[model samples]
Target: MAVVASLTDRKSVQPGIQSLVDLVSGGMEQVNQIILSKAGSNVELIPEIAKHLISSGGKRLRPMLTLACADMFGYQGDGHVTLAASVEFMHTATLLHDDVVDESDMRRGKLAARKLWGNQASVLVGDYLLGQAFKMMVDVGSLEALRILSEASAIIAEGEVMQLGAAKDIATTEAQYLKVIEAKTAALFAAAAEVGPVVAGESAEMKKAARSYGMELGLAFQLVDDALDYGGSSADLGKDVGDDFREGKITLPVVFAIQRGDDKDKAFWKRCLETDGIEDGDLDHAIELMSRYDAIADTVERARSYGDSALKALDRLPAGAHQTALAEAVAFCIARVS
Candidate 1:
């Protein structure tokens, strides 16, 4: 009888996200258990709505980062598990809120919670998850962790408001868009990575290194997602390919294209984005213009630069499988676009 190699071994043919997932699988299992347990509620509607999105096939990358960072610091306590779950709950809450705000129809390749349960339930359930998340953080007895996460929560809310104002505004600058994503997406990631070392009693320098790694990784991840909006398949995006375009989101591609476009191209963007006067062929034309201006390629190049930063951030940490896997994770994020 022939014996088959483990999936991890096969995946090791190339160093990528799967290797990171394998490295952190033990801790991630604990995090998953905590996430499922805490996601339950006495109120029937809460679990129903929460599960709709929770079970939806997100990579759970943020929580996994918390687990990996803690493990890298030799943390053996259960605090990282609880904190990882808390990070995920915070993320899920934001997603529920985001779908409602964006008026999105799908999430993770399925109908959004709002589409099935209405905006009220989505918002309320999001609130409930957030409350539970805080409860867990408090239970961990890590005051510093709680402070970091709470601040991230406030920053994320601010980012949402910033995005709301920037929407359909073709004049939105690249700096403004970067600011929006830094708050909305990267803040939680930084907090998640930072808290791991805090709980592990690691040095402040190590904590800063972890935080830097996560922030740069998050930026690269979002930039790739933004570029993929115009160039990737729905299978890759887990939502409609042109959802950002339809929503009048001023992503990096749009920013670059607008900056470099001529008079006719600017007018076209103004109609499709600013006035919400999108026509049938507008998406195709928008893609054409973005391609003509090399917007997608430039956005991808920016993501790669951030990916480089993330790898450098990991250089401060001690050498180990976890650190190597974390660096590979950064490579994997950039590879998503490639």
Candidate 2:
């Protein structure tokens, strides 16, 4: 497919996620309403910090998954909307916390919340978002959905801690890195999708399939993001290129490069990443080393593999517009590197 080829070939036009966006538009409107309503607080700073990130132009993909999965089963209820909003809050909370933890300056092409509000405010607002999310979950009154999301929250936290442990460690293996992303990123995707079926009263088999789709898709999504941190421009990536490298984040491409590098290359990684002794030519040299090893290409290849698995998981779901859009969504994610 042209979209698959687009993983490595920028000239090929990608099939975008617009289809999924269109399919879930109505449900997303409800989700937006809930999000805005719930984000409100008498504490001025709470709403200020919360709305700053909430109003920022994230794609709201996780909540969209919840809505689409529920709608796929021909569900007709407000519960899905509530759950979708909760998923979004959980995601927003994570981002708020992530920016602070990563010491990031930008998000979605704008100044990160931490930059504007400071770390203490950003973290507190993130906690507030989580509180609002849990309250909404209880409002939905689905113990199963609550269980899935609560567990995901805890898993995501563990993943964050895992990433901290692996950070700047050039010796980090591919297996170790995978464990980090699977928990930090894919856990929420799995929960967002599984809750749809749970709220819709679908069978366990279908819920399992949906969770598989989401988990695999999340992995693909994150892998592509890792690739883009090196391969893509800021305009396309919504953040400065090489941010991961600058932050000493150990990702798949970095893992591959470190494994394949010679002693000199290894020493360079140690200086730039482990010791944070970056010089003027360091970023360029780092990119060159990754290119020499074909690290970015290999990382994209891995993402395509996960994307393939995500597409297969979609096949087990009910057939409809949602399935097609969701499948295309997988392709769209991987194609971002192009």
Candidate 3:
């Protein structure tokens, strides 16, 4: 525990999001305003629950990606702002639904919408937010952007369903779990970045670059998160540590641990996750086993590989302050677990 803990707490010299935030702050203001205005509804609970998660302290990274990608390519219209807000709405809607689906009690260091308002209200508000997201996308009037986002939405749902099917199934393979995160997490990231060039009328080559950067960055982001579930504090994830283990999620590290662990270890995982028979010391034991097997270290190593790929994708774009900030964003994301 101490060794992994030390690694997570070690100082990261990598660049942070300040550059990215400075670059996108003006546009993000517009995105925020649009978000608040569109979140309103006649139904009181809708606004209540929607605002709860919306105002939570997520980095707003996906929307920022939209703004940065568009700005880097000189997108001059306000359409990018609308689309950024739409991206955020899509993300918020997913979080709301995810909390319900994962049976989570917390989000962003706060009570989950489902915890405060029932699962039904949380789900309905999530639906409302999704509807709002599409309406905003339609208002942008880019059929290509609309198509990209709509398809991403469907893929994300499929990822969720796939995850539901995989949960607590310790037999879940590493490749299968990657498929889940690629769909559930990376799809929106790809769409968020690709739509920027789609709306900005950049060449298809640039669109491909942006999508690849986003998809790779998203994979690194989620891989880091999987590692952090055991190695990081609640502050890093904005949720209780070990939530994945408690939920029986077959994250990358769990896959590695299971493959490398012995029969006694297999029984332990089955009891804690498969059968929900966790005891007081189980989380510590889980972390110990993961450490013994280098599961967490290997997961972080895989994240760096994806992070490197994200940087390579960035190299395909024009070099400038925006490009630099976007590049630093990848490093910053991976640094979260450092």
Candidate 4:
């Protein structure tokens, strides 16, 4: 709770980013309430499972992007708040299911939903959250919004599926890896950013700009996430290091390493994924391979490129405190380690 309250107090953020943070903070309260109410009183079990992930302090970046995108388009209607919350619910639902699928133990610095509630409860509550999310979107009464959200959800599912299949496959290329990230990670970001412009009735060009900004930023975000999995401080990242390797999940860093790795390193990389439950030393070895290939540095540069492209997408937004904040926010995508 203190974390949530303190997000707005980061002095390093520009005013525009602060405004978006404030709007997102206001919108998330309604979204949480809506989720609990929709789960019903009798199903206290399910609500508790949902709350495990919901109450954990995520940055609420997706919903914040939605609100900021809406704000950029001069939207004053309250409908955006409902939609913003809806987007967050959709995101949380995915996280719940992802924890179950990945058999993950930690999220947001605590036990995962599946760990506390069991897989059955976690999966069911995840389903409930998805249903409630769509209903909230319906309450907003925009077919356009529905279509965008539905497409995003579908793409996200595809991305998950693609990643699942790619897991344990040594041949998974960087291009295929990028595709998976685009679907699983970038799709929701693009949709969240685009929703505001569509609802506010902005020009097609501006809507496209919003979409571009989000897609590029989202890509950068995921790349950084992969990089952090290998090199970041566990306390800062809120998850154990090398979870990706432990899960045998093929991310950009690994793919790049495999592509660029030397013969001895390549063979070692191959063996690492082939074995179940990576040894602690294997993580150090993996990092070494990535470092030698310069994959981590390359990944960071790629993230920076996307962050730059995200800033470019906002070129048309009128000069104001809000637009400046949005630009700073896009940069923060690469800056934040967590």
Q: Tens digits of per-residue lDDT for model 2 on 180-279?
A: 9999999999999999899999999999989999999999999999988888899877789999999999999999999999999999999999998989
lDDT of each: 0.89, 0.90, 0.90, 0.79
Give the per-residue lDDT digits (tens) of candidate 3, residues 58-86. 88999999998999988899888899899
Query: By the lDDT metric, which is better: model 2 or model 4?
Result: 2
Q: Candidate 1 — what's its lDDT?
A: 0.89
The C-alpha RMSD of each candidate to the native structure, in angstroms, is 5.1, 2.9, 4.9, 5.2
* Candidate 3 least-lDDT 10 residues: 1-10
Better of 1 and 4 by TM-score: 1
Candidate 2, superposed: residue stretches over 4 Å from native? 1-14
lDDT by residue (238-332, candidate 4, tens digit) is 78988888888888888899888768877777777856746658888899888888888888878877777776676665456556667667656
TM-score of each: 0.95, 0.95, 0.96, 0.91
Residue pairs with colliding backbones in model 1 are none
Q: After superposition, how far is residue 219 of candidate 1 from its true place, in Å?
A: 0.3
TM-score of 2: 0.95
Name the 10 consecutive residues with the lowest summed lDDT in model 2.
Answer: 1-10
In candidate 1, which residue ranges exceed 4 Å CA deviation? 1-15
lDDT of 1 by residue, 1-338 (tens): 11212223434323378877898888888888887888898899998998889888898989988888898878889899899999999999999999999999989999999999999999999999999999999999999999999999999999999999999998999999999999999899889999989899999999998999899989989999999999999988999999999999999999999999999999999999999899999999999999999999999999988877776788887677787778777777777878
The reply for model 3, stretches above 4 Å from the true place, is 1-13
